[model samples]
Target chain A: MARKGRAGAALAIAAIGSFFAGTVSTILVAVFAPPLTAIALQFGSAEYFSLMIVGLISSIALAHGSVVKALGMVVLGLLLGLVGTDIYTGTPRFNLGILELSDGLNFVALAVGVFGIAEILRNLENEHDRDVTIKKVSNLLPTRQDWKEMTAPILRGTAIGSALGILPGGGAILASFASYTVEKRISNTPGEFGKGAVAGVAGPESANNAGAQTSFIPMLTLGIPANPVMALMIGAMIVQGIVPGPNVATEQPALFWGIIASMWIGNLMLILLNLPLIGLWVKLLTIPYYMLFPAIIAFCSIGVYSVNSNVFDLYAVAFFGLIGYGLAKLRCEPAPLLLGFVLGPLLEEHLRRAMIMSRGDPMTFLNRPISLVLLLLAAAVLVVVLLPSIRKKRDEVFVEE
Target chain B: MKSLSFSSRDLICGALFIFIGLFFAIQAYGLELGTALRMGPGYFPLVLAGILILLGIIVIIQGTQIEHEPMGPIAWRGLLFILPAPILFGLTVRGLGFVPSLFLTGMVAAFASTRMRPGTALWLVGGLTLFSVIVFSYALGLPFRRFGPWLGQ
Candidate 1:
């Protein structure tokens, strides 16, 4: 197997880019409360629900592996979320008194174990036998055609992500997925995906970054979280006992506005950081699989253990890793499962809450305009998928590894 | 020559999904599920189980209709080691501590390599161990205590 000599350079660039992107987006979300709040003050619950609906659908788009496998992964994610604890009660659901699982599986542990450790296992199995050919050196610059193809998708993604981010749940991640799906569906060339379509990278990347920036709108204005990351931010706020609400912008303008200004600054920072570092990031691809696999395992173990200082998560990681490996062997992509796991609980909780609010009227789903719209969209997708003429296209879309 | 196919395997997988969905439905029934409006604990799982059952039926039907392209027999050696590695990690990780457990795990995993030589493998393992320690402990600042903390400390 030929190693990409420049992988290290490429990886370094990506790391720098991602760091800047992540940090700037975070700061912007944190700082931009007052002005953005004023701008978004008119929105209400329906808008919030629509945003969440969009996020949920879009998150499903993020799985880049086999469609069936991704679906299975999503289901598995939902199952994990449901395994323990009734939200309304103080009682445990599936902890079995292990205590670590009382809170349900930690996201970090699940992510690290399945993605990190299982990846190592797969690499190890293929190490020596696998041909390690790296592509011939090519220019990193995007061509004019590539730029033309990417611009519309990126703008659309930004709009979709920003709008969704203003809602109470479904943050940057969901926006990323939503943007990806939109771009894919609308693109004239739908088949040129999974092979690093510039649109695939550019659009979702833009959406996520923009979504990350906009998610602070609800958190700062109305005191609601758009996604888990924003939830973490809310935790940070609560530690200070600043009960987040509509008045947050009025009460703490600098804290709100500073965070917003920082986002713009942060995006610039990321672009600067990542642009020159791509070469370094690329160089990381050169590391021998032997060395890389072990590192992945070590990272997974460490990441999982740090979540709770418990050794049990380590065991869980290994277990999931095995499951991940098995899924891989079956040619199933694990992305969907991961997404399902993340969204399953939310979907369940929301659906139940809606039912509870409606007091047994099943028509509530159809009667509510927002709910009806989302359901209709979902139906449209299903109908398109079920058509015989689209079967080959569906397979191609879902089975991309 | 006459050919065999994965029709049986597909059929089995489809059946397994259906069974799993039904089991979930049964479990949902045991929960206090309540009225449609006042959904108890089991509403979501019940819905999911129903959906999964539908999907399972589809899979079974599709499997029956598809033609399987023949690939040769499985590589038993690779299969045996690779399949068990994750399980072994799960079984051992908690009690063993990170470094020692990982060393053993990596060593075992290396056996899946088709052309691995013993000496080369040993060197790779050492490099892996060191790199892992430095990157995870030093770079990421993860609290990884070396095994026993006695030999060098």
Candidate 2:
């Protein structure tokens, strides 16, 4: 979306379509993923705890750069997450006499500070260098040939996304990446993969949308969130006094069905508004960093304040802004940290519960077959990351041969 | 010398990690830290802190041994303007109400950017203030006072 030039229109159209596709997929999974319903009832605390560890590891896989730095950031995020009043004891952990800090740091503040402000700070240094090309998007829709090329890839992507989306640690990101790999392997014009093939856009777009929607499976039915967005949704549900779990479907059918109805309506609105508003979005991109950033700051501040009409959240955002920038400078990506932050409390809760249930034996994690599998999966991911780098180092030595 | 150079960025990062870990670990020390079987609030935090401290050491080692790009100059101006703008809003929002506070926040932020002209800033602020009022107060019906208690309520 940030890149300029000729492929922009196709990318934009595909992205817009993907938005609606994502919405449809979410509803489909919510209604149809029966296995997820079963898993919700069956999962013990041990299994859930193991699953969270797997989610943490999988998120680590998503971060680029040194493992040590990424892991450190994840830990930092976890520690930050540990702030606020302990649920079990009702005593504040790191509030330090500040009454506002008792409820913990506002997530919106932290997110906006990290993602919005830190990003702007990074971009500001290169403000003079960035060339925002005002290229006219002459074509509004995909051509018939474009549609033909997209169809197969889209179907294949949707399939890939929908399947993976049901997994505990899986979501749109994994789906999109997996679909891209599959598309590249199966594509007839494999050479065109990187250089903006129609299938490239179509496949990932569909898959991303499908994955986004289907990833809600664990969130809605099972109560265990797959990602930070799902965690936010869970938080939203809680604020509305709805406990998100398997029983939610039967107990509050209106809320469940209302969510489904709203999602479809939102998709329809997005499809209608997006293209006509593309010009507006493009115009927004053309705004200079100096002007754009202040606006962002203003909006983020207002949004943070609106969360609880509190001023303390502003300080939290500022503090996190510096931390986020510092981590980014150290080549640590924030996504894994965000994921870790979202899942940290749950991980602690489940781990404690499982341990208590199993009489504190460390072997209980290994004793449970499901928990054992999850641990093995996490170990496998670590090895996969380690093995490839080792091979690449060896390959460098053999290049002359 | 350049080829064998270390990254101060990584060194600072390592130190930061260690510092944060140690801080938390020490704080948790006073708390009840039960065994892993029947863990206390302090136990999990201690474990995480230990992991962080270990990772920090590894990071420090890498920083001292490996060659990487020198850390670039910090955007101090952006940081100064961006960081304070929100604080200013928080301080003033309750006093001045949402619209004026928003305008002031926008103005302060606008001045942060050396490139933004005064006339453009004024126009932009005006537009934004209107938009925020409409969207937040009128459309969304958010609970912020338009005039505020400070103005002789």
Candidate 3:
């Protein structure tokens, strides 16, 4: 639609869709969070372990490309996560005797290196003069035809996004992708999808915002991060001396309600601010990639260094950047690795605790009904991903983007 | 008869995974492997290492059967300059201070693209450094020295 000079309409549609989705999802979070927290308070180590297993396996399922490769990436990430001092024995495992290794790798450094620096390198691979043509955005309001086309997709997207957002490891990216796939499949004008149908923009935009809003559910209720952003939020909470668990909702009702209220206000502010700032965003797009990347590199260095005032973290950023680029070259998805990195220590802790509780009985996982259900769900997801028909369909879904 | 062939991308990928898996496994083996009821720090890693090795083998086997696309262009220039930007900053930030270290880092990174002229690179880096100093150091009060003792400040 932007290519066809419907930039204003596209932007407005996206803004409206996102606002609607955000409102609905915020309400869903408010209504559902208390009950969810009550249920989560009952969970034990076995349940937590099974839950993380489901999270890990689903990340693998959702990742693009080979299943075996994704699994390997997760394993590698787990090993990397274990690089610091062992929590149980205080034994330094993979630090190579460096004192910095005792504290383990900085998460921000790893994230910036893998996702940020590696992305810059990829963009630099085919550096050419980009021809950015900005069309004057005149019509901010959607036509009646566009409104008719977008209503059902926005509703469907909101529902899908809200549900998926509550699952650990599921977030805006997966929700938007899933929503786009559904819109394409159900649309009578499926051919118009890649060319920018109104449903294509409206559905994914709505889903993305909705997913982002409701991902807070898992974070607020269970203290389980649904995505990296939630992980960062948990980190911040920990810094503030707030233990993020079911008790948080009860103990800090004001803070919990305040965050939910802010979500709605944030959505409203986004629409109010962004509609007028569309021209500024388009101007930013006109900046040359060559000029932009240097600034990115400088800021990344400063940001990473400021985290702990540790220069070693900066070196780690460089090291992980190389690894990230190498993995990209090798066709491995980095998302699973990142997710694994975040979950690794927690997973180990829960596994060990559960085993200790069960007196070394491996059947303890199956003995607990909730744990059994979660494990079964993980198994079902793995099996479905491995199926030949679904595998092909999965590839096709990714290829559309 | 079909010739035995392998996807080089997968072949290299599998070898990398196997190598890393082995590296972790050997280290874990040196640690105490406690019972399942009370897993030592190493036990969990050892299990993960084993899974990684198995997955690597599966990837290798699959590579032999499947004909994959070529690996395409490697970012040699980007790798040459871009990877060092942070390392350079790390090395010099304390000694040279935030301003010069950042300027140097930006200058190096700017050249990652072949399109960047030396003059353009210098201008871009200079501007970035100025902006960062104003925002990060002055405004945000990140306790970075504008000029370190090495600069006789």
The prediction achieving the highest DockQ against the true structure is 3
TM-score of chain A in every predicted structure: 0.64, 0.88, 0.94
RMSD of each: 6.8, 3.7, 2.0
> Every model's DockQ, to 2 decimals?
0.28, 0.73, 0.87
- Model 2's alpha-carbon lDDT is 0.76
State every prediction's TM-score relative to the real structure: 0.69, 0.91, 0.95
Cα lDDT of model 2 by residue, A1-401, tens digit: 22335444665557655765766586676568555666667888888888777767766665566667867877887887888877666657766777877777776777777877788778765557777677765565677777788778877887888777766556777777777778888988898876767777777778877776777777777676776567667756765678787777777878877777776676667667776776677777777777676678888988889888889888888888887887788777877677677677777888888898999887888998988998899888666655767436433423411
Error of 3 at A228 (Å): 4.0
* DockQ-based class of model 3: high
Model 3: CA > 4 A from native: A129-138, A185-188, A235-243, A251-255, B1-3
Lowest lDDT block of 10, candidate 3 chain B: B1-10
Q: Cα lDDT for residue A231, model 2?
A: 66
What is the DockQ score of candidate 3, to 2 decimals? 0.87
Candidate 1, number of clashes: 48
Superposed on all Cα atoms, model 3 deviates from the true structure by an RMSD in Å of 2.0
Model 1 / residue A200 / CA error / Å = 11
